[model samples]
Structure formats: structure tokens, C-alpha cells
Target chain A: MFLIKHEVQVLDAKLDKLHHDIMTHQENILILTAEWSYLNQPGRIESLARRHSDYRPTETKQIINIENLPYPKKTSLVRGRIDGD
Target chain B: MVIKFDGLKSQKSIQLDGSVNKAIEGGRNRLLVLSCVFCLAFVAAGVRLLDVSVLRGLQEPIDVVEPTKENLKIGRAEILDRNGILLATSLSVSSLYADPQEVMDINSTVEDLSTVLVNLEKEKLFKKLNQKKRFVWIKRGITPMQQAQINALGLPGLHFQKEDRRFYPQRNLSAHVVGFSGVDAAGLAGVEKQFDGRLRDGSEPMTLSIDIRIQHILREEIKKQIINFNAIGGAGVFIDVDTGEILGMVSLPDFDPNVLNSASADTKFNRATLGVYEMGSTFKIFNTALALEAGTATMESGYDATRPIRIARFTINDFHPQKRWLSVPEIFQYSSNIGSAKMALDFGPKAQKKFMKKLGFLDRLPVELPEKGKPMYPAPWKKISTITISYGHGIAISPLHLVSGVASVINGGIRWPVTILKKNSQSKMFGEQILSLQTSKDIRKMLRLVVENGTGKNAAAAGYMVGGKTGTADKQSPTGSYAKSSRLSSFVGAFPIHKPKYAVLVMVDEPKGNKKSFGYATGGWVAAPAVRQIIKRSAPLLGLLPVDEVSPQIRRLLEIKTPQQKRGNQLASF
Candidate 1:
């Protein structure tokens, strides 16, 4: 039983390390997303697109706040339940 | 006989049975054909199973779980000054949390943690462990050293959640303009609150008009003077003459945004932008500007400054009383209250109000800062109020308000919004033509005279054409009376009058008379020298060339009329 308990402890350590690695990867994704948005700023993107890509810049108005933002079509489906229920 | 016959019949019957058996055999052959067909079908089914399982093994396997970990919310954008200085930013900090299921000895871990983090509550830590939660926070935003020490304890279930803490790198250097953030990282005051949404967009750094270098110089000068004088408080502002940009603004008794909890209300008070006082003789510049703009006075126009004018139980007299005739230039040079009152009388009440309104003194200042205070003008607009305001006593306005108006007076009469940020080339110039170009020129000529011959002689920085006005007023006590002993002394001046670049102002509140001031803490003695020191230090930084004393620009700007020089009479160098 003592040996079994020791094995369980090692397994737990491995599980914890795995969880930490996953979280670290998740954080890296967030940082990449932030950097992507930073690069995609209207001015920066336009300059880049003009130099290296076929995409064109479009005029955008400042959305004053989050509450006043327009809703997306697929947003309601996020909870995994359908409207029929 | 019947048996024998039966035997004979039996043979025939046996023959018949054989024929029946043959027929039965034929049926059996048909059944055997059906059995063969059934075996063929079973063989085909086995071949189909082999084809599906073995031959199709190269095809991709169907997935059991879907991958959906791409979308997450982003944090707010950073705010930086024009030169890429970090005015506001976020730092990643680790917060301690725990999972009770993995904990070996909760009591020992809690005890060790509480010792490291002295502020941690013992009961709370014990309760969190006993509550049977999988995870709970022990502390938020512990320093890295604390985290390392806690980790060294090898406590089970101890974990950390990485968080972003907003940091102001410049600290209280420009607190009033940069403002501060709340615990949730929301802007609570100043520019942070005004541009809150823009900051959250995360597109680019929000650049402000403030220059950290200029801000440092202005704050240092104000702090030095405030300390030296041992006064209650003071404020200083440096404004661009042509563009109306506020290069620097400093209010004494400012607090660091990082240590905001220990700050008092007075420390948080933004005196330069929010505190409005009856700016004494600084308004004389405006009064003279109005007189010149209204064509009410010429440089040579004479006003009697010999006696005090008693109007309705209030006497208007110059602090340095000159019981003699004075010209318009002389009136301004000596900062004579009687002569200024006469000039205001010449402009009259209607014209004076109209001119001040044109300067944007009657409303809130137009700077980008949100901590602006409205001017306290008289409600009834009486003649006495106009006359008293002429010498700067009745109407109260902020130091920023005075700086903007003074910049207009020197920058050929264009009152633009004072800016902290450097203006990009695309921004169009904004202001109104309050004074004619000729009137601006004439005022500049006279302001230079104040530095040369008048009470502002102490405000001279050698080789720089410095011109300004001195103002001293009694501070009103709480019981509806003016305190005789307390005074607010202020000086406002600009350099190289021919081509003005900056306007600097220094104001001291309730300064006591020290031995150095010879029992007199008036603007001329106390505030003028502060302005002189500021110019001596700030001029070279602004890249202003201190021309030769005999340079035509200096000669024309600072020429004051004087009687033939006596043998002992020596001219001041600034």
C-alpha cells in the first residue's frame, strides 16, 4: 500500500507538470493573439499589406464601447444548446 | 395364405418404397443446391468484412473530441508619451493559490506563508483550507522574492496565477496630467479617465502631449522654491509661446501614484489646473493688453499715480507707492495699482469684460486636461469689480488660465489651447485674434520695460530679454476677512521679447516674510527671483541664444526712458 501511495504521488506530480505546461501554452497563445492584434492596427496593417500582400485598407469608425458593439451570428451557439430547446 | 400374399405384396411395396426413396433423393439433391448457395453467401460476407477492416486501415481515424481553444479576451492597451516614454503600462505579477486535495499539511503551509506575508490573515488562511475548496488564493501580487521563498518551502498544492498589474513608470512626475488607475485597472482620474475607451482598444499606445524632461525641470524648480520659502504650496507652468503647448505643469505637494493610499487630499489637489485664485498683478498684463487692443492707451499716455484712489471705502494703491506722474509703460514697469485702475477706467466695464471673454478667461480653459477649473467672475459685473479686477483682485482664475492668456499677449495675440503633448505637423493651429498685431508688438515692448526699470528688475536673467509683471494679494481667511500677514506672490515672464518662445510662471501661496526678503515677501522680492532662476536654467535647455546685451533685438525690446544718469546710477544687466 505504501509503494502504491508513492507511485500515486509521482503520478500526481506528472499530472501537475502537465497542467502547468498546458497553462503555459495557453498563455503563449494569448500573447501571440495580443501581438497579432497589435500588428493588425489599421495603420500598421495597411502599410504591411501595401508592401507585401494583396489586401487593402478599409475605413473604420471607433466603436465607443463594448455594450454598443454589434452582435455576431454564431455567438448565441457558444453554450452548446440550440434555440429549439 | 394371407401371409404369403402379403410377402409377395411386400416386394411390390418395397419396389414402390424404392421409387419413393428415389424421389426423396431428387428432393435431397435440390436441398443440397440450396445449401451450396447459402455457403457461397456466407463466404462473400466474410470477404466484405476483411476488405473493410484490413484494406481500409490506411484511412484517417474519426476524432472523438473537438479542438476549440483559440478565442480569448485581451487586456487594455498601454499609454506612452510622444518620445516612447512609458507613462502607463502593465507588468505580469504572480498571485499565490492552492489546491486542498494535494496539500500534505495545510496548517504548516499556512503558518509559513503567514510568516512570509505579514499582512496575511491567519484565520482566513485556516478557513480557506478547512472549506474543502480545490483551489483558493493565499495572496495576490506578492513580490517575486516572497514567491521564491514560499516555493522553497515545498508546500503541496501551492500554485500561482499570473496576472497583469498596471504600472506608472514616471510615478508622480506628472500625476495630475497622466492620472492614476484603480485596483481593477480602470482609469479613475485625469487623462486616463478621459481616454479610457481608447486605451482599452489595444490597437496602439495612446500618446499624450506631455514631455517628461520639461516636466522634470518644472517640478524641480517649483519644489526647490516651495521648500526654500517654507510656504504652504505653489504651482509652476511652462507654455509654448507660438503653439500654446503646455510643455510642463507642476503643482507642489504632489503624491506618487504608486503610493496613493498614503496621500492626503491636499497632495492630490492639482493647483495648476484646478485651484483658481485672484491672480493679482498677472491680470495687469491682460488689463494692459485690453487697453492697447481697445485703443484706450498709448505708450506715452499718462496716468496720475501720486495719490491713492478711494472708491466706495476701498483704496487702490501701489505696493511700492510712487507719488508721482506715470506713463502707461511706467505704470506697468512699477506695477502701480492706481495706474492700472486708471487704464481699466479708460477701457470701461463693457470693453474690459469683452476683452477678458475674448481671452477665454470667463470660461473653463481649453487645455486637454480634464482637471480644469472655471474662472470665478463677479455675477453682477459691477464697475468696482471691473476696476478691482483691472489690478487683479476681483476675478479668480487658474494658473493655466493665466499662462494661456499671457502666451497670447506675447505670441502676437493668439490664445490657443495649452497642450502637454508635442503637436504633430497635421494638427491645424487653433485660436482667435484677440489683439491686433500692432497691439501685441506694443505690449511686448512695454513688458520688456518692466524687466529693465520696474519692480520686476529682480526677474532679470543676464543676456535674456525677460519681461513680466509682479502680483501680491492678501489671502482671505475662513471668517470672511482677508489675512493681513498672509500673501500670494506671483511672477509671469517671457524671454527674448523680439521672438518669444516660452512663458514661465511661479506662484507662492501664503509665504512668510524671511530675513532675506527684509520683512517683505511681495512678488517683486520673492516671486521675481524664482522666475529668474527658472529662466537661467530652462533657457539653455530650450536652445534659446542669450544675445549680446547690445544686440538690436535686446536693445529695442528692453529700452526704458530714464532721466540723465547720475554718477552713482548703475543699470541692471538683465
Candidate 2:
């Protein structure tokens, strides 16, 4: 009984440490995503591109349509359009 | 008895000694076990406490995580000209907060903070320190320098929160159309208010009908004239003739959204979209078009413009006072009020109202601007109103409404709602037909004649085939009567009359005439020249090709017989 209880306590400590490590990793990932979006905004990208590149970037006016997209090979898992009537 | 005592004593002594040693051994063993258990428990408790209080923050943890706040912004979407220039944007700034619990050296801290934060009261900051709150806001949107100084004080508990603030970078440049964002980022006026939903929440930037470069030209030239003539206010607009887009719009006395609280009401008012004025002879284009479209008049049509026509309580007279019969083209070139009134009489009020309604002049304009005015029209639809409105005196409409209407007149007679969002050219073009293509062509001819030989002669740019109308309406006093002296001068013109591409409108209110203008504050004298300057500067930037001044096609399309009165005279000089 003593040995079992000792093992359970050890497991609990290990679980707690894992939780902290996972939480810290998640926080870092979220911060990175926010930074990525900020840097990717067109105004900032255009400024950087103009500074470094000889060619001016062209403005895009296309709106992606679902029907025009390619179908996935795993057809069995695919369902009806996510955005549709 | 002595033998019995010796025997008992010996046995007792041996038994007692043996038992005492055995009991001591057992007691020691139990004490050893208990000591080991207690030590283990103490170490476990200490480790758990450390993990909770220091590592895992299960106890006494600092609440460093920022709470997710609700977005409380209500302001309109910003309008940007085509080039991604910041016609409008939101700025994020640091707002100061206080943590009373952390504050030490309160009096000194307050004194130091006051030196950096100019608007803050030292006494108030000191009073805040006396409060029991864990946190309180010291000020919203403190300058970075102020924040740095506050930080230098090392006052333990001072904190800051970031706030998003709306700003118009191109301040007052396209004031009327771009509008201004409100304190909470809600669209209170112009495009900001009009497309608030798209601007407030959408991921993409909103593109407006404005061209920043053209907008700058219009504003600079208009400002020059306003300063030169000492005008009360000036407004200008540019439109794409083909797309029905407003390229540039400006209203002087514009406010900077950055210092909104300090700006006066006059600065906030948008004259181009909100303030409706009697556009005077600018409306003659509509009248002439309506007459030709309804078959009530033709290019060969003549009106007796020899004398001023007396009506019930009004007498219609031309500013130049031509005392002879006028052809349709001559009437427009000369801007004959009598002739316009006669043409309106033939067309009748019902037709005029219908045509104006179809031209989108009756209701509030369908532009992506929130501050547009609902046009003021007479309820009774009286004949006098018709005659006066024909010459642009009785009805009042916003300059934006006029721009859209004129675009329809020239853009193959189609009315497309002006927009601020950049659009894909391939998107199916949608517009309502407002006039016959033939009528639109004929109006173009007459408009070209005005610039070539009419009141709009001053509006001509050397190579750009400019066609426009000049208007000088008598300003009405607050007492509901027209003032004899004050005038509201305006000019609306389009370029490359054979194939119109852009329209420009400039209006100046209460202009004090100067010597260069010969003490004249009429539209031709004040506003037309501003239009000319804007075109001269914006033409190259727009990439419009400079044409031969006397292009054969332009000359043939804009032919006008020199009137009999001026036939022998040197080409009537401006």
C-alpha cells in the first residue's frame, strides 16, 4: 500500500510539470501568431518590398470561390461545402 | 524470614532490570519510525508549498495576464483614396493607470509625474494615491515622453493600458468625403459613418472614390483662392465621368481628428456633403438636358432673351444682359436666366421634377457618406419654384448629389452610386439609365460650347477640352430672405468633352473680391479659375494625354455660329 501511494504521488508531480511546460509552449505559439499577422499586413509588407525589391507588387482583386477549388483525395472524409446553402 | 527476604529481593531486582532494558529498546524503535515519517511529511509539504506559491502560482500568484476586453468602438469606417494613402486610420496609444497599493513616496512621485504630464493636476494625483484601489487610471493617451518620465520616477505602482484611437492622416484634405472618426471610432460623419460596418469589423481596407494626389491639388488651389479673396469657406469635388466615382472632395476649415476636442464646430461641418446651397446657374446643365430629352427644345431652339422676363413676383435676367434672341447653344454660353426660365416653362414642373428625381437629386444621395444632406424642394411644386429652380435658385442640393447627377449627364446617361472601396474593374458594372444616349451626347455638345465661347471660357485648360457652368447665387440671410450683397459662387466642369472622363466642382462662399478679379466674386471669376488650376496640376498625374488645342474631331463636335451681334467683333475676349 505504501509503495503504491508513493508511486501515485510521483505521477502527480510529473503531471504538474508537464502542464506547466505545455502552457508555456502554448503562450509562445500565440505570441508568434500575433507577430506574424502584424508583419503580414499589406501596408507593412508593401513598404518592405518596395525598399528591397526592384519590382512593385501588383494589387490583387480576386475572391476565392469554393466551387473553383480542387477536391481532396480523401473523398470519404469530405462533406458538403462548409459555406453553402 | 531472612532467607525468604534475600530470595525475594534478588529475584525482584533481576526481573526489574531485565524489563527496564527491554522497554527502552522498544520505545527507541517506535521513536525512530515516527521521526522518519515526520521528516518525510515535512519535506513533501515544503515542496508542494513551493510549487504552488512560487512555480505553479496556485497560491499568491501575480495576475499578469491581461483580461480580454470588449471592443467598444462605434466610429465609422475610414475612407482611403485609391493609393492606400491613409485618408483615415486608427492609432493606438498608451493610457496611464495607477496602482495605489504599489505607490510609495506619494508626494514626490505626484510632483515628478506632474512635471511630465502637463494636463495632470499634482494635487489630484496625490489624492489618487490616498485611494484604496489596487488600480486607477491617471490619464488616457499620455505622450510617450510623459510615460518615460513617469517610468523614471520609479513609482512602484504606476501602470499603462493601450487604447486604440482614430486618426485622419490626410487631415481636411478630403474632409467632406473622408469625414472624421468619432471619439469611440464610430462613424459620425461622411464615409466613416456611412460604411461603418465594413470599416469597423472588416479585415480589408476600404477604398474610396477619392484620389489623394488630385485631392491635394484641389485643396491647395482652393485654399490659395480662399486666402487670396478672403473667402469664408470653400468646397471642391472631383468625379470620374466613366465610373461615377468621386476622385477628390474637400471642405475648408477642416478639423484634425487627432485634436478633435479642440476643433470648433465649423471645422467639423462637411460642406460638400452636409451643407446644401442654391447652385445657381450650375443647374442650367440639367435644365438644358431635360429640355432636349423631353423634346420641348432642340439645339436649333430659340428663346427671346432680349429683355428680362417679369413673372408674378420675380424678374429673370442674365448677368451679362444680352438684349437679343438666343440660340440653345448661345443661351448656355451666355448663361441666360430668362432663356432657361422659358425653357423650363415649356418643359413644365412635373417633367422637371421627374427628371430631377430620376437624376437622384430629390432624396439623400446614395453615397458611402453619412453626412449627406436631403435635398430641399418645394412641397407645393409651384410654377415660380420651377422657373427659379430651372436656373438653380429655388432648390438646394448637396455638391455630392450634383456630382452624381452631372456624371449621369455625361457618362452615357447612367447613374452609378459613388463608392469609396476599390473595386475590380471586371465586376459587372451596374447603373440605372437616366437619359437617352442621344440626349447625353447633345448635352455634351452644349457643355463644350460653354467652355469654348460661354461664361465658362475661363475654365478652359489649354489641351483639356473643358466644359462647365458658372453659378453665383444670392445668399439668403437667417431671416429667410435673399441678401442683396452676399453671394455663393460655384463652378462645375468636365474635361475632354467629346469623351468625358472626369468632373470637377469648386464652390466658394462669401468671397471678398480683389483687384485682380476686377472686384467680381462670381463663379466664373473666383471658382472657375480654381478649377482651371486644379486641372492644370492634376492632368499629368491622371495620365490624360495632351491633345491638339484645335483637334479636328473636338472642333467639329463643338461648332457654334458666332452670334450676329458679335460676328464682326474680335472673338469676344474674356
TM-score of each: 0.73, 0.74
Off by over 4 Å in 2: A1-85, B1-79, B99-107, B119-136, B561-574
Clashing pairs in 1: B209-B420, B209-B421, B210-B420, B210-B421, B246-B419
lDDT accuracy of residue B458 in candidate 1 = 85
The lDDT, on a scale of 0 to 1, for candidate 2 is 0.77
Compose the digit string of candidate 1's lDDT tens values, residues B1-574.
3457668888767977889789889999999999999999999997887776667746854642332332222355666665656677655668898888888887888888887888888888888887777988778777789989888887888999877766666777768887877766788777777777777665466777666666776777667666767788988888888888777788888888766789889988889989999888878888988887787887667789999999997888877676887777767766789999998998799998888898888999877667889899987888898889998988889998898899998888887877766688998887887888877877787777677666678888876678787788887677857786887888898887767788888888887777777767777777788888778766766666566656665676545444421311232211
What lDDT score belongs to each candidate, Candidate 1 first?
Answer: 0.76, 0.77
Task: Provide all candidates' interface root-mean-square deviations.
Answer: 15.4, 11.9
The worst-scoring run of ten residues by lDDT in candidate 1 chain B lies at B565-574
Docking category of candidate 2: incorrect
Q: What share of the true interface contacts does each candidate keep?
A: 0.00, 0.00
lDDT of 1 at B263: 80
How do the candidates score on chain B by TM-score? Answer: 0.82, 0.83
Q: Which one wins on lDDT?
A: 2
Q: Model 1, residue B356: displacement in angstroms? A: 1.5
User: DockQ score of candidate 2?
Assistant: 0.02
- Tens-place lDDT digits, model 1, residues A1-85: 4686699689878876876677567556644544553443333444677999976422122213365457775757764466546
